[model samples]
Target: MRRGASRDKPGARVVQPPVVYVHGLGSASTVYHAHVAADPRLATRRQLFVDLPGHGISDRPSGFRYTLEDHADALAAALDAAGAVGADIAGHSMGGAVAIVLAARRPDLVSRLVLTEANLDPNPVPKAGSSGIASYNEDAFVRGGSFAAVLERVDPLWAATMRLADPLALHRTAVGLVRGTRPTMRHLLMSLPIDRTYLVGDVDNDLPGRAELAASGVRVEVVPNAGHNIMFDNPQAFINAVAGEAPRVTADAYKS
Candidate 1:
C-alpha cells in the first residue's frame, strides 16, 4: 500500500511532483522514507512510499514474477494510481535497479533519479542478499528455514522489513535480479536523458566503470561513514542527496 501527505505546505499549495521512495528486496519503502521524511531540510514536495508487491504491507500474488522489470511496472502503476508524474525518485539496492527500469520504460513518470548503492550488473555475486536468496530453489527457499535464516543474519535495520516479505516473492525477485534485463540496468542508466546521480557509501566506494558513468553524465557521489545501506547508516547524508542539497545543483545560464 502507498502512503503520503498531500502538499498543503506553508503559504499557497505549489504542487510539485512528489518524491517517491522505492524499497529494495525484502524491505519496505518506509525503512528509508520513515527516517528522512520528517527532516526539515527535505523537500516541500509530498513524499510517497511504494511498498512493492510481496513486500511490506502489500499483497503478494502467488503468480507474480517479482522480477526487476515486474517491480518497475508495479512502481509505474502505483505512481499513476497516485496521480504522480515526473517525480523525483530515490531507490536503493534492488529497488534502485527497479527504478532504473522504471525510468527507462516509463520516462514520463520520472524527472530526477538518486540511486543509492544500486545493482548495475547482472548475476551478482552469490554472497550478498539477492544472489544468496537466488541460490535456493523456490520450494527449498519457501518451505525450508532459509527465509528465517536470512532474517536472522541480515542487518537488524533490514531484517525488520525483510521478515515481513513473502518467501516465494523474495526468492523469485532474487532470481530475477540475477537474471537481469536484456540491455542491463547499467546500459539503460547511461542512455537515460534525465537527471541521474548514483550515491555510493564511503565504505563500498569502489564502483566499476566510474569514469564512463561520469562521461555519460551520471554523477557518482559518496556518503561518508556508511555502507551499502546508506539510509540506515547515515540518513542525513541520504536526505541531503535526496533533497538535492549536498552535490549542489548549480543554476547557470542556459547552455542550449
Candidate 2:
C-alpha cells in the first residue's frame, strides 16, 4: 500500500467480520458510505471503504502504473495491513473488475463477491469513458486540457469524485482497463470457486457473457429501477444484494 488505504472514520462498534467496498474509476469509496450506513444488516459489519491509489484522499504516486493487477496487489496489502482477510468484497464498475482480479490474484483476501455492473469484456471501444481517457497520450491528457474537458463533460455527480483523481493515474488506469490484464478479469471471475454474485440494472440487463456467467455458477441478479450506478439509483436493492436477501427473480423472469 504505497499511499495507504482510505477507511471510514473510526468509532462505530465493530461486530461482524469486516467487508471491503471498492469504488469505480473517477469515484471514491466514500460513495458507498451513505448506502452502508442505511443498511441494518451491513451497518453492524465493519466497513473498509477503500480509496484506491490516485482517487479520493489517497496520494498520487507518479511511478504507479494504475493497472488492475497493480490496484489488486495494493488492495491485498491494505487488507493484510487492516487484518481484514477473508472479507466479503463488493465493487462497482471498474472497481468490480479490480475486485475480480483481487479475488483471483489473492484469493485469501476475499470470501464472497458482489459486483455491480462490472465490464466483463476484455476490450471496450475507445470512444468514451475509460477508453476515451485512454485514447489520448499521457502527456496530452495530464498536461493538456483533456482532463479538464472530461471533468466538464461528465455529470456533476461523477465529476465531484473524478475531480479528486490524479490525471496521470486516471489515464493509466483507463488504459489498463482498455488493454486488459493477462488472464483477463472475466476469465478469472468465471473460474473463481467462490460465492460470486453479479448485480446489473434491469434496464441494462443484457450484460456481456451473462449466460456464460450464470452457467459458470455465478448468481446473476437484476436490480430493478436502477442503472449502472446501482447504489445511487436503488440503495435498497444494493443492500439486499449485499445482505443475501436479494430478489429471487429467476433468470427466465429477468430475460422475459
lDDT of each: 0.81, 0.82
| Residues 1-256, model 1: lDDT tens digits | 2221222122124566678888888888876667787777654668788888888888788888887888888888888877789988999988899999999999999999999989998988777699888988788889988888888888797788888888998899999999989799999999999989888888968677776777778877767899988987898888888888767322231121
Best by TM-score: 2
lDDT of 2: 0.82
In angstroms, the error of model 2 at 139 is 0.4
TM for every model, in the order presented, reads 0.90, 0.92
- Clash counts for all predictions: 0, 0
Tell me the lDDT of model 1 at 95: 86
Q: Which window of ten consecutive residues has the lowest lDDT sum in model 2?
A: 247-256
Task: Give the candidate number with the greatest lDDT.
Answer: 2
**lDDT (Cα, tens digit) per residue for candidate 2, span 151-188:** 99888999999998999999998988887776878888
Model 2, runs deviating above 4 Å: 1-4, 9-15, 126-128, 248-256
